[model samples]
Target: MSYVNQSQTLNVTSEQKYQGLLEKVLLSTLIAMPCCVFLFINGTMLFTLRSKSVFRGTSRYILLYNLLFSDTVLLALSQFLYTLAASKIMLSYPVCGVFTMLSILTDEISPLTLVVMSLERYVAVCYPLRHATIITIRNTGVAIIVVWAFSVLNVFIRVVLLLDFPFSDLESLQMTDVCSDIDMILSPMSDIYDKAYTGFVFLSAGVAVISSYIGVMIAARSASTDKASARKARNTLLLHLVQLGLSLSSTINNPLLLAISKTVSRVVFARMQNFLYVCFFILPRCLSSLIYGLRDQTIRPILVYYLCCRLTLSPQPKLRPKIHGVN
Candidate 1:
């Protein structure tokens, strides 16, 4: 009776192993499909931004390029790690560190870049005369650089905290748990520091975006302000706030999943996690392309053209007569 009552399996069978593998494949495939689609869209958007001189020359467009570049890389890295975890692959400490670090580095850049973009819009509406001098190409490039440097500094602190772990004591560097940033939290201090850092970054970013929205709204009411331009700027700032909120939501994925796991069965938890991963992770990154590409009149046609595999979506321009009146 006692033997029959044992719930744990001491011996693993080949059939059970195959069943596990099959389930993993099924789950990963589901996530990978949408991830691939988003990646394609993001790639096309990135290429479209670079293809036009107008896009390349404009300050806001340059900032948009920086934002999309980070989002694209973050999405790709995340999917990679997700696939590895789903496949039950465990990476060594060093290998996983590099992957997660790159992931975090890119992940942090999105919100900060959004803040810069928001400020650019705010200035464009609030101080139209100075906008040209203020939001110059060189200044935008410097702002992009600063955003990256700040994110890198955050990642550097994380690396320092990781060193607190007694890695040398282990017989081998092979990690027993699935490789992830959460798994790498080997100490209480590390977890606390991560929470504090994430909270501060997101809170600061939220404030900056909201403040910009308010500034733009105030500028819209000014008598001298261009109503149409201010209205457009106001709308864009609102969308930036939404995008920042979505990015902020991603930082809570681990904590949220942990809370949900206790109340649900293992199977149910797994399903919920897969669903939430796509909703919280993939959709947020995909949003940037959709928000900018579909909404902006300037980008809409060219973006659609590239997205549809270079198929023309607009009326083709007629060629003018060549030299010597050649038609």
Candidate 2:
């Protein structure tokens, strides 16, 4: 009787552990699928856009391409982190710092790119005659380069400060056993600075996008010529508004998660957070690309062609047997 009870207890424990591992794997897979899909779709879109000279040379497409590139990198990073967490792999401080830096760099650049894109649209709609002069391909390229440089420099400064301030012991920093959101010990000032910087960037981008769209709507409304064109422009702006809202939600997601976490059990909280992450972060990344691919006249055909080719359903010419010696 004693032996049977011990065996039963051992089996139950083993089963619970197995269930936990299964849950982790399933959650990780769930988190990863959307990121993979986003990367594939955006990557194909990037290739298709770049392949055609007509699309490649346009300023709007250039901005869109950069946005896609940033999103792909961001999603790739998220996938990496989630996979690591699921596998119980911890990263050292330096590795974690690098991951954090690159993540921040991409995240910052995404909104900045959107801001530039919105401004580009605003200029095109409000001042159609001078749009070409104001937003040239060369200028767009330069702007993208500048945005990257700024992001890199911003991250570098934060990293330097983080290193300078001893966040626990060096051993702690190098320890790999941590959560997906790496918990780094920062000084009080550093913490404040980080929060302020994040808020400012988020707010600034949000305001710029909203204001640009408003300007575009007003310009479209007042324009006397090309009513149809103006209406189309308004529709495009509305789509952008949706995309912008989705992008900005990342900034707010953390707080919301924290609020909900307090009210839930550990397992429930984890599930809720995972659900939120997929819905808010991963889903939006794909939806943004879908919106652009579906709505943009220049990109729509190429996207459709790419999808058809991917499906192996593109029309093929029927083969004919040539008569021997007919020629």
Candidate 3:
């Protein structure tokens, strides 16, 4: 009996140690991956910005750059919150509310920007001759500005209304050490508004993306001479669809998981929630940057060349200069 008791104790101790190690590993990954993603995205944006003549002037690259910028900001904010949570630091209600509002703004902007990008691709692929005239740099810039302004206004209004809600008394709520998804609560009216807002934005964007891709397919099917170009267009559209799915999942997954986990043990729910947060929210943001860099023909070469130059500490090869004929 003594030996058996000792063996059982030893096994329990070992399991506890393993669980502790696993949690640390996960925390480290949750912290490190977003930082790496932010760096990679900003680096690629810098590279694109440097080649202004080729990339900066194009409408597609302009939309893509904005998308990158938004995603980078989102990742940075997420990392900041993650670090604070890891350190067991609690933000005051107002500060947490600000961070939450900023995060939502960036989150909304990402998918909205993607919607514009898909529409731009649709025009480029389906209406090749008119793409340049229609999707001009100035027009694209104006559209981007509108997107930012609208996102800011929308989020600000929602936050203000939330503050005004009778049930949303920040002073009455207990403050915790970690500002996490579970800490946020929406009054009934705000909850309704949130659902409506999410549905409208996501549904509209989905419809636009789906319609644009459908148009691209129809155009590709009718074209006889540019089969290769059509295939490339289809591939790019598929990539955009994948990215869209990933972005939408971040919005949908959390609520679904919360509903399902309601009856589960608190310990299990907490672990599952954190895991899902990292998988659905953080992982998708990181992959978005990778997907864009790898899949974009124009950006791919530049990203690869920049990475190579950085790794080797060597100057990039210069492009052959255009020569003008003597008049």
Which structure among the candidates has the greatest TM-score?
1
Model 1, residue 208: what's the lDDT?
93
Give lDDT for model 3: 0.76
lDDT of each residue in 130-211, candidate 3, tens digit only: 8889999899999999999989988877777667755464455545657754355456766777778889888898888888
Candidates ranked, most accurate by lDDT first: 1, 2, 3
Could you say which candidate leads in lDDT?
A: 1
Clashes of 1: 0
Off by over 4 Å in 3: 1-26, 29-38, 166-174, 223-225, 309-327
* Per-model TM against the reference: 0.90, 0.89, 0.82
Give all candidates' CA lDDT scores: 0.90, 0.77, 0.76
Model 1 spans > 4 angstroms off: 1-22, 313-327
Query: What are the clashing pairs of model 3?
Result: none
Q: Write the per-residue lDDT of candidate 2 for residues 75-116, one digit (tens) a residue.
A: 888778767766778777778777877777887777788888
User: Please, what are the lDDT tens digits per residue for candidate 1 over residues 164-280?
Assistant: 999999999999988887887888888998899899988899999899999888878889999999999999999999999998788889998999999999878988888888887
Q: How well does model 1 score by local distance difference test?
A: 0.90
Q: On a 0 to 100 scale, what is the lDDT of residue 137 in model 3?
A: 87
Worst 10 residues of 1 by lDDT: 4-13
Residue 229 displacement (Å), model 3: 2.7
